[model samples]
Target: MTKSLDAHYRAVVVGGGQAGLSASHYLQKLGIDHVVFEKNTVAHKWKNERWDAFCLVTPNWQCQLPDHAYDGTDPNGFMVKEEILAYVDRFVKKVNAPVFEGTSVTSLEKVGNLFRIQSSAGSVTADSVILATSLYSQPFVPRAGERLPEGITQIHTADYRNPAQLPEGAVIVVGSGQSGCQIAEDLHLAGRKVHMVTGNAPRCARFYRGRDVVDWLADVGQYDITIGHDGMAKKKHDTNHYLTGRDGGRDIDLRKFALEGMALYGRMTGVSNGKMLFQPDLKSNLDGADRVYNGINALIDRHIAEKGIDAPEGSPYVPLWEPEAETTELDLAAEGITSVIWATGFTPDWSYVGLPIFDGTGYPVQHRGVTGVEGVYVLGLPWLWTWGSGRFLSVGKDAHHVVDHLAAHLDRTRRPLKQMANG
Candidate 1:
């Protein structure tokens, strides 16, 4: 028989990164007796991420948890990994969020309305569990990746950190997403011949009103906008652009790397012997990206025109917007790209939760994160509600909203005082 563990709180939070920490912070404010279970140290993934010269795409001014700022000299600047880690550490201390570090929640199952969670440290019965782990839990290398010839070495972008870590031979980055592009650029700069496998070319803003695109988003309520599935799909289809470039006093573009002859390919299908190959439709993907960019520009113009908005006499004219199509698949072995980094995107996996309450997509079936499975909630999902809920720097606010909703639910549905005392 399993030993009965204490159930002192209504909720238990999983993970110790920004999402979990932020949830714990709000639970404290609401006087909820809660604890965070972290499989590793604070911001563990960030520490383990292969983020060489990586900086937050979101601006620093918007990157603070409630009741705490980064507390550094450059509060308005985007922070690197070190700065972010330090900030999270400080936030934990400041809020006094109850956390159990090194404690990993191994499994979770819904027993009636309550969730029985098993952890490496101990078992806990919580009325609810907040899964704050990021969607990037699983690095998705393509299926064909497994069949590569034994002679070549393969490393996902998740495993890539710096230029020196890569093999001396020519490198090919598989995905055209942010991670793939960044890694490709880094490898190329390190004096290694690099090939960027084209999946799809994304539209990137030239300048958002004479400032960084991130800055413009913040200014134009993009961060505040809550978009649902339709909105998110529209955004993705409409804006194929990925955020790139270092901050250049508010406006920096990374056209230099592209202009420097980064060898571009169509796409990778498979590998044979030791030779890597690529498809021939590489130009089509590039063209699709261009069309997307033009579409976004056109949309901006339409929005301005529809509003009959008057800009300053010297202001740049905004273009009308439209969305471009996706790209076709390509052959890999023919192009001789031995190494491939899968940067397609990320998805949330709640298999460990082991709860039947999850949707087909592994997301909790809820109205704004409150599932029928009592005492369970979720936060920090992309576009949680059409209003730009899960942006790079939007976790804190999302956590707060989730915590509030959970707190109210717990208060209204908590077991009676006498029943609690007997337990």
Candidate 2:
């Protein structure tokens, strides 16, 4: 719903995703006057950017929005796409946020003491700004995809719906991140021939010991660990371990797929003539993924033993299949490959904000959600505060921290003015 836009506000939130809405909830709780500008409808990414079988990798219990947690019966289960949409919709209605849907903030700059925002809906001024855009807003397909035969139907996973959507033939799925692995499994399960280019992204067991790995990790306080932990800051940039929550949660084991006739390849190089090329790193990629998988399980084992928890025993993962021949090249036509799915993921684009707050990598320089520059705050970034900071579970916590700081800062500044006026 479009609301009446005013000339000025105490705070202005850019981007109306979970992060933005969470911040809006807190600001409203504190009686702060603000407007949330959403370029698209709320949860637009979830609505459009996902494949058909999309479900939460984390359990439904982790759907911790501000003032709302998952109240469904399937707390341990993952919420499917439809349920996820409904959840976000409920939050939008609950907040009754002061938002301008379809309003895009084209540019934002600090004008004197106020932040001036130019949006599709027009300009507005604010005392402070919350840049609440998601971590990855733009889908990235490599230029190498262009080198492929124009005959092959090419798509990024964001556009992928199901196996029925692709032409009937073998499909080459690139990248081994969450989407890549899951889509490959989806196609494979649908009896479509799948050839995957497995990247060095890690994998994890969906269930370890007697409970889901997520439950165990949460018990170990993993989600609460901040980004400042040793060797943890860099984890923000790491690829999430490949797993799936479809038809109940399960590990996405590429080796198991390979054993079941799914051809596995290494990183994609380029296409020449009709042949798809790859580096001869298939064996190493598989092993590296397994190491992370086993390592995580081992951590859980230690925690269980130390606490003497009576959980079912588990064993380390032994490779189900190994690649003896690393095929660095493949004749696409001979292999009957008719389509390519690039699950290469996304990159952040924040060119509109006329601020020197971003790092060389385009990440905003911020402590928690508060940016280095005064009056500028960023939210919903992965590892912004913790491992789950960008996730549904922890986004609310981060929002509270930032809004608390914002409120306190405003109050402290206001006290001086009141004192000066009275004096």
Candidate 3:
């Protein structure tokens, strides 16, 4: 049963995903009077949004909570959806967090020295606010999709469950990111003909030598590196490298799928009259993805050589197949494409917060989750502090950092900001 929130708290944590729950864990340990306001239930997105076969993209060992790391036997193996949710459930129980599930914070504004949060239940005030809401809350579908004939069914990746759920005909999948390529393969494996549009998203091998590529990279101190380490803060916006944790873990080779009869094209420019128009960059896109796959393997090889590590010898990835000719347009009706899946991606929705902490693009301007505002912090967003800030591998660490800074601020004042505000 959910608990009714009090009129006030020393701190308020928004969002109930790993980020919020992790913050709750730290706050509880320090005996801080705080409440976590979850718009939905705990682990809401993980429970509802993921597909049937969805599993962790990284290894299970990466599932680090505040103190309760994954104790499951298969540290190297990835947990499927059920196991993933169970893990989160256990963490919630372990924390014994004061989480107000199903409460939505509609708006947030600074009232004098205190923070006033307008919520679905009513209003509340707090000395400090921690936003654990991530940026990928809203799924995006292009408006040009409206031009498609009504006969064809269109859905975003979030809505995709299985091939059997779709119409019994060839499916057109746009955007070759992790979701796009994986869903295309899922449909193709189900004997559904897939007409896929490629994007510039890169690919990497799941295992290069003896262990998972992530294991190798972690050994080389890659995940520990902060965002913008290579002068590429933009890398945060780059699509995740195409791979899968399904059936343990493995690489997702789009070229191999192409060789197996999946029709590949470049980006979908628009729908003209009744046909789907595409950009003329299929060849370059495929080549670029392959280049990244091979490059990652090369880096692993260099690491092995430098450390004199006894690992299996490896070589660059060889393309299984290539486009014989560029395909710039697709006739949906002629090709019998009855369904279209837009695996495009998502954007953040932080408009509820009435604060001047956002940039021109509306992204929060924070340093390791600390906003310029004295009593507010943002956590669990991509590139908030590092490459893994929004990922299971690093969200807990990021949460700890946020809570530590917030705890110190409260300690220094030795009184609630609301008390100061009233005076």
Candidate 4:
């Protein structure tokens, strides 16, 4: 039997990651009686989901939490997974956030004028609710994975720890995003044979013109640009380019992988009778990546010229690998490939919320975190307001905006009651 406890607050924030923590910071400043309910410990995903060698693609200075910023000596350095977790932990302590660790919100529904949140520990009612669970909630693997042989081992990027975790054999890493390329590099460096399925994602160097690409983007106001502005919405939905913050920061070009003896193929189409089928568009994929790469460099060059910034002329990026005619299908047994790593990506899951604010695709339909449902808001969704809205550098801004709207909503709704009581 489940026991119900009496609890109430002016606002309830679900999830205890950066988004939730940021929201809590603003709520504290606003003097809103609120509590953050986390499914596990604070920043659980950063602590567990990431691999041992994983580092943030963005630099340390970009880790701007609400009321807290990265003040470390290595501002340009990338933060390792543990470092990120520690930073979040420090922020939680600094703000003295009212977070209930280990508590999971099983369901949320609207009850009369209040939002009723049922959790494993108990229940809480709040005038407003902020769903800051973030976009990366569930690991997404393709349906073709089910067709692989029983002997083969499969792991998603979320569960992958290191090369040693996989079986000793040639490993096929599906998806050529940042995770896929980085994992392939790790496995190759560990002396394991690696085969990667390359996609059409772009690639960019860590630094250009004596400055990190992140710094250039930030200087040019790229991060501040919102989605739905021009063609940004389409760009936001595109697969991220191949890049890594490991070993300092570097580009994860397909050509580089090919030169390193990693067998590269086009996108994984399907699996049939223990054979993995791939499209023979390696050249096209490489070309697409090069286009985006050159485009970014061009933008940087233009920025330098227009601003008259004192920067050296960066060398033009050149592709090194030429495609050789390769077979489209690989016999798993014949090739000695024993494992598959799916670095595909993640999807958002909001089934726990019983609100009608979600779209047909299950994403919460909101305008800058303000849901159509009264007093219900969402945060940390990709492109919620801007390209960087969901990222750590900018989530604080989104949280502040949402909290301001929430406060206004409460004031408008509750002011009448206070006036009547005074009368």
Task: Name the candidate that leads on lDDT.
Answer: 2
| Candidate 4: tens digits of C-alpha lDDT, residues 185-298 | 889889898988988777777889998998998888888787758776555467776788888998777787788888988888899998999998888888888888888888
The CA lDDT at 368 in model 2 is: 92
Candidate 4: the clashing residue pairs are: none
lDDT of 1: 0.63
Question: What order do you get sorting by lDDT, best first?
Answer: 2, 3, 4, 1
Residues 107-131, model 2: lDDT tens digits = 9998887889999999999888999
User: Candidate 1: which stretches are off by over 4 Å?
Assistant: 1-8, 70-76, 229-240, 245-259, 275-280, 298-339, 344-347, 386-388, 415-423
Which 10 residues in a row give candidate 3 its minimum summed lDDT?
414-423
Q: CA lDDT, every prediction?
A: 0.63, 0.89, 0.86, 0.85
After superposition, candidate 3 runs with Cα above 4 Å error: 416-423
**Candidate 2 deviant stretches above 4 angstroms:** 415-423
Candidate 3 local lDDT, 194-300, one digit each (tens): 99999899998898888899999998887888875778577667788899988888999888888889899988899977799999999899999989889888888
lDDT of 4: 0.85
Query: Higher lDDT: candidate 1 or 3?
Result: 3
Q: After superposition, which runs of candidate 4 have C-alpha atoms over 4 Å from their true positions?
A: 1-5, 415-423
What is the Cα-based TM-score of model 4? 0.93
Clashes of each: 31, 0, 0, 0
Error of 3 at 244 (Å): 0.9
Per-residue error at 303 for model 3, in Å? 1.0
